[model samples]
Target: MKKRYFIWFLTGFLMLNCSCNDWLDVNPRTEMKEEDMYQSEKGFKNVMNGIYIQLASKDLYGKNTSYYFPDLLAGYWYKTNNSTENYIMSYLYSNSYVENVIKTIWSKYYTVIAHINDLLENLDKTDVHFTNGNKELLYGEAYGLRAFLHLDVLRLFGPVPVGASDGTNAIPYVTELTRDPSKLVSVTYGEVKRMILEDLDRAEKYLAADPFMLGSMYDLNNPGGNGVNYTPDDDWHYYRQTHFNIYAVDATRARFYQWIGDKTQAEIYAKKVVGVKNTDETDKFVLATNSSYTSSEKGALVMASEHVFAVNCSDLQDIINGVMITSSSSRPKLYLQNAWISSVYENPESDNRSKGGRYFQTDGSYAYYLKYYESGTIAATDMVPLIRLAEMYLILIENSTLTEAREYFEIFRQARGMDFAISIGDETARKNQVEKEYRKDFWGEGQMFYYYKRQNKTSWSIPQSVTIPENGFVIPKPKGQSAFE
Candidate 1:
């Protein structure tokens, strides 16, 4: 039987309005012509903002792929009822609902990619005058976003990681805007890795020239300035950390290198992000304090200071809390699996992550994922971290010596209020310790499954004495993408 998939495209006439508080607050308008939309800097900004907004939709990073389904696959959570979520938790890939969700993830990500391509294709045709730095920043973010999405697509659908293996075919690395279906074809796994790295290389070069990275010297009157006029409102400097900053590009490179089994490059890039060689200068990225996670204040768990790059979504908390069972009577329930809870967080009192880090019901029947939970009105400050400092530390420990690994591991453990004196035996034991910490550190943030996939693990331990099959590691590709087939 022949299968068909729907590929979404950005219509040429649609225009988007940008919001100052949250750039991702883009509302669509059909009246503005495509040419007019890119005629000014504000228009270009709106276009870029639209890509982020689209990416944060429910099908993409907003829920399914990032938190809900992937967590189920990771065996971190389980279904309390026989709902669609239960089917997902059971790894019923053939279920129509599950298949549709996977397809939406595939289609929606490409939709964002298509819009990015549209923006890049038309950027030069517009007459808007941008500073050299601003121009580079715009292009850099566009390229970086494209690479980021493509890499995730490969992670979800491509072959298991096997040390830069060139034999397996992977998802197409889309670069240009194209309606020509004939041009879409899967590339070798090695080719996709190289393409992603090449894009990151360009992103790093362009982003280094960005004024936002210049710290205090970005002001116009300062010495060695770009001479670009700036005002408080026009200052894009503060927003730099939220976007694909230079450090985030490096963090992404570290992750990619580690996945491809290049521990040397991985350690180098990971060190750059963590500032390991320069402890005094490491204040830019630090571990979140116990209070940051347990505070009663609204939007406390966004961990704004620690995030290397995150999505600015005001409704992030609402989205996460909505998936949770707010009350005992709530139907279609979802909660952390008891097995995972016992395995990782045996001592809730000593482990700050269990005490107030991730919320647990008073009765212990359920533990709500509270990492994205914000208690008040959604604002620009609310964010979902895509890359953060803690993960960098994990990367470093994974590639370091046993003694060195223990040192790094203790730093993270102590930061979380755990006992720091835990002894380590050897390199293998140190690596196992790192993996255990990963399960606890990134519980609801969607890193565990990828961690297992990178290691090519065949089974995932679950609550009900079940083991996830090797096929479970790879989600099925959307049916209509013949190129990937």
Candidate 2:
């Protein structure tokens, strides 16, 4: 087990850049011992921020997992126009390019997991005192992130549906800093599910105690009775939306329950997020408006308010310019299937999602996502959204009765400038409608593939008459990991 874990550690070291001069940098693991790194509260904060920085890298949410790769697999993009692009669209696991992509994803995620484990293991021993609830906040973020990363890994690399009785091997849910190879064994899909729920449960407990969730009295800027006079620099509470706050944890619960086929539990959690009663908690997330996308500023995007958890990525523009199909450049464009666009955005003029949601080239031959659009002025704090309230509504609709589902769906549709009087015929029609909305809403955000997998859809249409294979449902465990075999 020690050797197995060590192999992963080495792989992470080789694949990940241990040093960056930017704010995201974590001193190379060699320079700072684990004990020294956690000796101060500032050190703990650095590790937490570093994990987000790494997560925002091109390898994970920044590209492969969200914006670029999975969008193609989900049938959102048109057929490939080049060999390298073909590797992704075709789900070509045997291709060396695809192999390296999968390996990087596996190693990088475990790398973050390892760092998180180190934090959890050493947190109790820290000599640093955390006043103003910093300790709880740090721990809450750590646990929530651990669950978040592991769940995404399971979604991407673990078995589909995650309730398989065939005893298919799933990714290991590493919860400790293991030097012992014997402890590095992988868990089954069901076991991982339980472990994730356990982590989220702990996260909820800790995050519920967070100052940011305590009400207006705890607002960092207001500092009400606390009298801390907390500035933005001193107040980590200022950016609760960026971290996995309590609501985000609840939203995650909704997602987890939906994944495991527990509709009752899923709907309960989703309602907590949607805040059907219009409680203070739900005010944290507001639906995006037309100006949200059309405006040039960072927070202008209406979906920005809807984000429950996001990672700040200063280099987002560079990533978009390089890969996306912007009007200015088409070197490595990602084209949308026209049929899909028409199916989802039937009433383009009234649909805010179509009229001012994601941008398209003037020729209308391809559409480019503006979800991550940020200007030079706002570049300092650009974020990649991970969880949001819209997803909660989707989860509720997915598991509800036709009438109930349509009610939830109409709320979302009307918010996006569509008619609220729309109706669905039956359960099948409702399901299809729910799916179309997901494809429309989460186009570039990277939820489509997982959505398909969760539904256990055997086949789907992409452009150029291509059909995703059954084997394509699960990315094979990276080569040479006999444990995954």
Candidate 3:
């Protein structure tokens, strides 16, 4: 076995126009090119290491798109430039932050992707010294990460013309980063989804079936979380899990499919991850609901249950989940969106069994938002749950009938403290309720706003039914040149 766990090197300088030149230029870690970096196994590891550092960078995970956009789309509203503007404007108004965030997110992801592209180019040429299993693991993760990065870039920023007005519209695909001739090419939404799915399809097989394999077994763990001089896993573990090879990416693929209206594939991937969750203890996070605190199973499930597709909220993954929950404890924080709050709040009283099992702040805010995440309770820190039990099956049900869908969905309902009773209704009403349940259960999870917008087929509108302009759909590329470029 490798001495340490997982995967990689250092390029210390941030090289950002956003930062002062004094700070960024002073700390340039060893500057190396892809050819020089990946010459040996250790060299390849170095290149991969840079990829993880990029993932955790402020522009991407630390403080950029994923962190900012969700709040803008779902939370309390403010001006587009308001210090606390969340996801509302991008979804509701025609604004630039959304574009900026998308651009930054794209930039960060491709930086990681360029490393993968470089690794893929070089690794294939290296002599086989390690087991094929290890080699597959490396390339598999590279592909999966590449696929996911592309999907996210396209998902939030890519345009879908609801009507024929898009004949003049373009939903461009950026398979490789663009540079040379400086000309831009655009593809429609349907065409981009096709390519996105193809990347994911390659990942499904090349990627590992289990993400927590390292986390679940001795392969990943350390006694006091102190083990350096790592092997394949830890050296580049963040790149592996945070970027491409993560468990959540599988479900992310499902989500990407669902966004483009592919139910059968969505259900296939969802079933793979349904009810398989990473607990706070396992992932090293805190789950706080009022009275129940960590003791409440409801609180536990809220933090990291088998819910699908969450960005792992740990230094282990990238950046912290969010700011500390705004309370005395100053614990790690996770943002929950309004759509999620409303859906969970709207559930019938009889539905939630774990309601009694959660925490509540004595201070009178809304009982809904603070109860689960109050810093006063399980106060280590919580990761952002990009996906979860309740929403996974709920999506399945929305695409299914009362019987077929209910079989898969009840597991989530039970987990959410909902008592299962098939609400009889017209087909449309039942499906609508399923969609609503997903909305409530998944508020502020990040992906919901897009789902709601897509569910325009159902009632998935932003806070208001503003028609998203086709021109507004593109999130401009971030600043940098990559192998793709």
- What TM-score against the true fold does each predicted structure earn? 0.85, 0.87, 0.68
lDDT (0-100) at residue 85 of candidate 3? 50
Candidate 2: tens digits of C-alpha lDDT, residues 91-187: 8888998788878778788888987887787686666788777788788888888898888988887777745742666778899887565555667
Candidate with best lDDT? 2
Candidates 1 and 3, the one with greater TM-score: 1
What lDDT tens digits, residue by residue, belong to model 3 across residues 1-485? 11221112222224223223222232333443444454455555545445544554556544454434643453322233443353444443334544455555655655566556656766677773654355565666666666666666665655542442323333344444334333234555566666666766666666664334444312232322443222343333432323355455557766776766777877777665553434323431111223233353333434443333333333522233234134344323343333433344444344442243233222232222332242444442334444454455666776665677666555555545555465635677666667556555553345555654565442234333334443434344433322233
In order, what is each prediction's RMSD in angstroms? Answer: 6.0, 4.4, 8.0
lDDT tens readout by residue for model 1, 38-122: 6677778777766776666556666777777777777776655657787877788889988888877777777777777877877
Query: Model 3: what TM-score?
Result: 0.68
Q: Report the Cα lDDT for residue 56, model 3.
A: 46
Which segments of model 2 are wrong by more than 4 Å? 1-30, 166-168, 215-234, 276-282, 291-297, 300-302, 325-330, 337-340, 356-358, 375-381, 462-466, 483-485
Q: What lDDT does each candidate get? A: 0.67, 0.70, 0.47
What's the CA RMSD of model 1 in angstroms? Answer: 6.0
What is the model-wide C-alpha lDDT for candidate 2?
Answer: 0.70
List candidate 1 segments past 4 Å from native: 1-32, 216-233, 276-282, 291-299, 325-328, 337-340, 376-381, 462-466, 483-485
How many clashes in each candidate?
A: 0, 8, 42
